[model samples]
Target: MNKIEIIARRILGWKLNRWDRWYDFEKEQFIPVSEFQPEENIEHAMLIVERLKELGFSYKTNGTSGACFGDVCETGETLAQAITNAAYSVADNSSIDEGWL
Candidate 1:
């Protein structure tokens, strides 16, 4: 899986359902949440930020250099890349259910 997917399923504890999907306001169309790439879509990316907030963490990005969550900070060329990388920094991907362990 990709970085955003890993962050969603592993770090965010997302369990997929058949009905999993979302509406893209920007594109004005429906899309599968399972296929949502938060790094490329700002709205969906905000959802990740909100989820992180609910999880008792805060995020900050310079929009050009990097983003940070708690004590971990990661740098990237773009804001989206930076945020995604930072979020993925906390992912525990060694789970048997995810088939990576």
Candidate 2:
């Protein structure tokens, strides 16, 4: 699986269905990634924000399209991308904590 897929499964707790669509454990159904594209969809991107909060991180997005979570920070051309990058950072850190990185 790609990095995003890995993060979606390991960190975001999603599963890949037999049809190659993603199964959201919380939602309990397979959904198209495009419809739930966190990098472009605000509603889905909020999932990352919630996850950050659950991980005990306070975050903020500046007018310059930058997002910061403690020591992990990233900038993107758009707010969604910035949030998505933050998710990736969190997943990477989590992997390190679990000694899988």
Model 1, range 1-101, lDDT digits (tens) per residue?
66765776655555444457544443466567756776776666666677677776788777786888776788877676677777787564243244321
RMSD of 2: 2.8
Name the regions of candidate 2 deviating beyond 4 angstroms.
Answer: 99-101
Model 2 over residues 1-101: C-alpha lDDT tens digits? 65567557756677777545788777788877556677777677778788767767788889557888777888888887788787687677643575432
Tell me the whole-model lDDT of each prediction, alpha carbons only: 0.65, 0.72
Return the clash pairs for model 2, or none.
Answer: none
Error of 1 at 50 (Å): 1.1
Per-structure clash totals for the candidates = 0, 0
